[model samples]
Target: MLQDHGFDVQMVGSRKAGLMHHEGWPGLRIDEIDKKARFSTPRLLPNVFTINAGSNDCLQSFKLDEAGVRLGNMLEYLWTASPDSTILLSTLIVSADKKTDLNVMRVNDQIRALAKQKAKDHKKLVFVDMNCEAGPDVRCLVDGVHPNDDGYEKMAKLWVNGMLEALRKGFLK
Candidate 1:
């Protein structure tokens, strides 16, 4: 949808499966960024950067502070790598299981606050709340974390709309 709109988009994923799927799409560039690897070069820069991760980080039993620190470092690296990039940071999605809902919510809140703070400091930063528009019936998971195809499509629509809205507001161009 974004490509149809003439935006040069590239997607990077931490997971191998995501990389493989995105690689098959025409005009879609996919890069695999290993969490354990050093952050050196980014495939896309100074245009748009969107992150749809962190569920794994949470599920891996990372403490809140650790997760924040890791995310902060990644953001810093991205910004440092491409200062002019329009950064779109997404809030974490809610888990399907009610047992982990509170944790997910907490992390989402932290991410939102962090994004806000980062935006205040960085002129090009834009925070997008993916969780806000996702209703309870969105069926956002296949297991209890990863979004199903339907959920992903919904997310994509939300993101496109959000980007358009941001563009209209002059938050991004």
Candidate 2:
């Protein structure tokens, strides 16, 4: 999605595409950044970062507060790495059942609250609600976990929209 916008992209994600880069954890996820991995660092700091994670963490049974603290750690790392960069923190998408969906919402709420609180300190943190952007269309999803191409397009549009909003507010300046 970002590449489609003419950005030079270098994406490294878990096999399950969660935020964490840990290797010792047991699960179906593969480590994307084990030792000896090539092209580990970007040539330049990014102007913006749109993060969509926490679904995997939530599904993995991480408590909401624990997820928030871990996510906050990641956010602090990004801010320290690129102090001038704009960070767009997105809410997790919907899951299959109500129980899991509630957890997703709880995690997302924590994410949004964290972003809001951090924005007060670092002016570049912004929240983007992907769940609201995706709406209530089950057909857009593939199975109960992943999204279809159309769903991805929708996500891309929402990201672009959030970027535009940030630019308008001079948050990207």
Candidate 3:
């Protein structure tokens, strides 16, 4: 989308697309950087880093506080590695079940608070409230866990809008 708008865009994913790159998608740059490996040194930084993880982490039956701590550590690593990068943290989207939803909301609140604190400490850091932007009704999966096409589209729109808004606000130039 950014490429369509005339901005040079590069996509570095957690895994390689293998033969898919041979199809000639110039904008996509697949890398082997794992989400858990963001803490390492000499990190390859992008202008805008959008993290859409946590749902899987939450589904693993780990403690919420532990998950938050791990996530916070990852964010800290990203901030340290790319001090100038605009950090856009996304909240985990979960199923509509009341119990699971509450857990997701709790985790999201922690992330928001963490991002707010980081923003105060470093002006380059900003939080995008994907949970609110996507709306409560839009984040649900068919099994009340993973997102369907409608849910994915909602997420994509939220991310695109957030990136544009961040750019306009000078978070990322």
lDDT of model 1, residue 147: 71
Q: What is the lDDT of candidate 1?
A: 0.60
lDDT of 1 at 100: 60
- On TM-score, the candidate that comes out on top is 3
In angstroms, give how far residue 42 of model 1 lies from its true place: 4.2
Give the higher-lDDT candidate: 2 or 3. Answer: 2
TM-scores of all predicted structures: 0.73, 0.73, 0.75
How many residue-pair clashes does candidate 3 contain? 1
Among these predictions, the greatest lDDT belongs to 2
lDDT of 2 by residue, 81-142 (tens): 66687878888778776777888888878888888888787568678888884543457778
lDDT at residue 16 of model 2 (Cα atoms) = 33
Candidate lDDT scores, in order, read: 0.60, 0.65, 0.61
lDDT of 3 at 40: 38
Error of 1 at 63 (Å): 1.3
Report the lDDT tens digits of candidate 1 across residue range 1-173.
87776666666533346343131121111122323223433543445666655665555445755555566676777767766656667876777767466666767777887788786775565677777756323366777766788777777776786677557657655
* Clashing residue pairs in candidate 3 (N, C-alpha, C atoms within 3 angstroms): 95-144
Report the lDDT of model 3 for residue 133: 45
Backbone clash tally (model 2)? 0
